[model samples]
Target: MDIDVFYGMCGENHKRLETIEHLFRDCEVSARIWAGLDLGIRVENAKSLNMTDWIIDWVRYLLSREGGVKRVIMFIAILWGLWIVRNKIKFEGLAMNSRVISGLLFESINEKVRTLSDQVDGENLKKCLKGGSGEHIEQKKSEIRDGHPLQMIGNQEQCNVIRVEVDAGWERTYAAAFRWVAYDGTGQECMRRQVRTRAESALQAEALGVRDVLLWAASGGFLHLDISSDCLQLINEIAGVDKEDHLIAGILEEMRGLSSYFHCLCFKFIPRHFNGVAHGLARQALKL
Candidate 1:
């Protein structure tokens, strides 16, 4: 039998020969996605590790963690997203962004969280999905907010709840930063974070800021959140009052999925002047 030799090429970069490690971990695009996930998995340290052993070791390590099962699920989701993106680029000749995979990962993880039962692993998965810290908080039933401005929680009612204000700083260059400041019931600052990302527009930047705070607050076990943002359009999009722009539709959907994790969640539109603290923080983060 006569056969022709086949050459394997990297689907993402096109210039390099394809190997499991290069396609999944070492490719420039794949490396950025892994870094974005912030899972603490050091791809650089695994230079000498075979792909099989690397996967197995991470699985075992995640299984030993507090939310091992859920973390494992997320890890699998990342791998799945990476594979799909690679296929799209190879077969469909499509250009893909790292954030697209992140959106897919959130959607997949959210769907998986719902099917989990009431077993210990299921509960752990739920906690992990909700961004709950390893703290014990009795689960309570809550419904998604309908986004009625009238239904908005008043400042008086927020006396015992965390009032988290989120804002974004964006430049025409697409460099952006999201900042959130959390205040205790008494209106004293308790927590704050500044994160960097890229966005195409001001509205999209604002949406990303809200999503960032939601994930952080949930992870910190802040079950009841009153999240305020200065971008009224983004708030309206989240509350279903206005149609979300195509640029941020996926992020809005992900935010809605995260809403279920809280005992109560409220979205409030604050004037830019009132949101000065978060706005200033976000701008300052851009310089960092």
Candidate 2:
């Protein structure tokens, strides 16, 4: 049973030797849980490759980039949550903690990518509300009621432009809920919010609901806001055209420093049927 006497010891000299890249990447609790998963690839720079060619060169550099399938399913859910916390610290002796194993590997990869983004947004909102015509699906539900879509931007006029619509509702017990809705410029609804905390993904609860709806529309002094979501990689990582180094990169750098307190912010990607009223108030704030 020589996988170093069936994974016996690796650090603090209890007799170091458990291989498979020393128990999943030079164990000291797997190098502090893969260096607390900032995931720009390390495992001691692929420790002279072996764990299946360092996970096939880190899933081929995250499938050649751009939110590559949610960063290769969050690097295979943090290497299957560090091999189930190294088999629950070697058969239940249990007591490891790289922040509770990277918060249960980002809450089980954000509740399996928010249940596969709600079954591909319920089949793309039933194929964009198929074949319309209940008065054209009530005029495309009054132009997405609030996620804005009537389309006009140069000189405003998508009624007059305000629309917010954010969403989030991850679970796996790290909990998470987030909502936002705003809608003015004729679609009506004016304001809305919802919270609930502790997020570890659903893209960090949609980047903390776009940094709390851009600090509540710049402290209610709102200006031409926009900010939609249905999480197109969190609107392509807040419009810098996608680049996220995991754990929602500090809530997308606090939503790009709250987009300099917007005088005219924007960010869109609607689809969950024009973000169905902020995804039904983020699944009614995760059922309260």
Candidate 3:
């Protein structure tokens, strides 16, 4: 049988031939999970390349990083999870969604992280797991100026800047919701907003949040701003270093256009622990 016919059409888009490229890159289910994992700029930049070249670039990139071993393990877990889900759907007629696959990948990675935390450098591995440490918690407290608990941690350069934290919750079968909260350098809540929208993937949902928040801030005349998200891939794409040639490309382009309106704007990636409030709001919005 032809490879395309054997693998079958992509579950996310039935019209496309289910080649490896389409399954891993173009399919909505895989695209969202990959985006959520945030492998780094190199992985994002390699998206347009063939699978062999992409894998080579990704492995080289991982091998050169400080906590590369942990990243490689997580990458393997994600791929394995994707494969398992794909096989289940193909062989057993199991219906899997992005949310389910993402959850499985995350859980598998977390379990691996926990098992390796003792053997590896705890601090670095914890950071790799996207979990903040006690030092981070204390730093977050010290950043608060007005005595109001913002539950946000900003970069050192973010002092006196409007730090906006954005997060999205996506369910393949249901609508996605995005929530953003703005905090002053001193960690005082300045503004908060939530919106419900339809998105085919979590990556698109995140890109939408970044685009909308940038437009909202620019319109409000917030010149000095720092946009942060738990989604590192989103930030990397916004910075123009990581190019994602997928469904979220248009949203990223809009963000690039809106970014020029600010006097001084920076995109940063925060660990999920530092972005608890905004993430919580996003999860809450999903239920509405």
Candidate 4:
């Protein structure tokens, strides 16, 4: 069948060329879907412009992570889901909600994993969805493995430490915002701040947020601090677990330098939901 075809723009956003990279990773809808998955995988950090190379690179990276095989499977499933969503929009004029796509993917993966549980070493997959009853798994929100152990501080010395949560929101236009909320030892709110800035990538935005938060804590006379962030990669890089990412090396170095100002400061990783307050604040700052 021969048909007239002229448009080359993405079906989902109609903003960029309908290349494989844009369809699967760069599209607005695809971005939202990935963010909603709650996986620490950052599509914005993709280093390759070629689709095949991009997939291979991400698969290799995921295989080295904690839930190796399971992560790979989900990565593949997300690509497949994105394609399905693109086709639905392109052929049927139907715009699927990002949450609906996420829910469907989770349900499909759960059922398939269950059906094949006895056929393979599906233990990791099963564990990932343990509390799930054919619904989206809450565990995925915090699945990024902790990079390193927190620096030990005597319990006596931690009595007056303030805890803070920091997060960043980034856009494709390079506009970014950083936010941090601090709480006293008694869990009372002490400081909350948001700053607008620009970043080259999401990782850079996260690193900038951590650095700003550390500076705020030190300058505000909060000598001892327990800093938390939902960006596991940033936390790991700061702890020297994953230092290969050269993109944010400068910010990380500044963060390390700032650490000396605090008598005791530790960076911790928390789930996205746990960092909701700072996350929302950062998103709000992006509008300013």
Top candidate when judged by lDDT against the true structure: 1
TM-score of every model versus the real structure: 0.52, 0.24, 0.45, 0.47
In TM-score terms, candidate 3 sits at 0.45
lDDT of 4 by residue, 1-288 (tens): 111241222333464336666767766666666776645666676633445445655665676678777676777667766655555556766435556556655665555555444454545434332321322221112213454434422232636988889999999999988999999989999989887777899889888788778767767877778888888788777655676478787566456545555556667788889899999999899988
Q: Give the best candidate by TM-score.
A: 1
Backbone clash count for every predicted candidate, in the order shown: 2, 0, 0, 0
- How accurate locally is residue 204 in candidate 3, as Cα lDDT from 0 to 100? 82
Off by over 4 Å in 2: 1-159, 165-172, 175-184, 190-203, 208-225, 228-246, 250-264, 267-280, 283-285
Q: How far in Å is the alpha carbon of 270 misplaced in model 2? A: 20
Tens-digit lDDT track for model 3 on 118-167? Answer: 46673453343342233433333212223211223334353467888999
RMSD of 4: 18.4
Over 10-102, each residue of candidate 2 has an lDDT whose tens digit, in order, gives 334436446667766676666765676656766666564446436655655665577655666666666666666566667776555456655
lDDT of each: 0.68, 0.62, 0.64, 0.66
- Give the residue spans of candidate 3 off by over 4 A: 1-159
Task: Quote the lDDT for 224 in model 3.
Answer: 71
Q: Which ten residues in a row have the lowest lDDT in candidate 2?
A: 133-142
Q: Which of the predicted structures, 1 or 4, would earn the higher lDDT when compared with the native?
A: 1
Off by over 4 Å in 4: 1-158
Pairs with backbone N, CA or C atoms under 3 Å apart (clashes), candidate 2: none
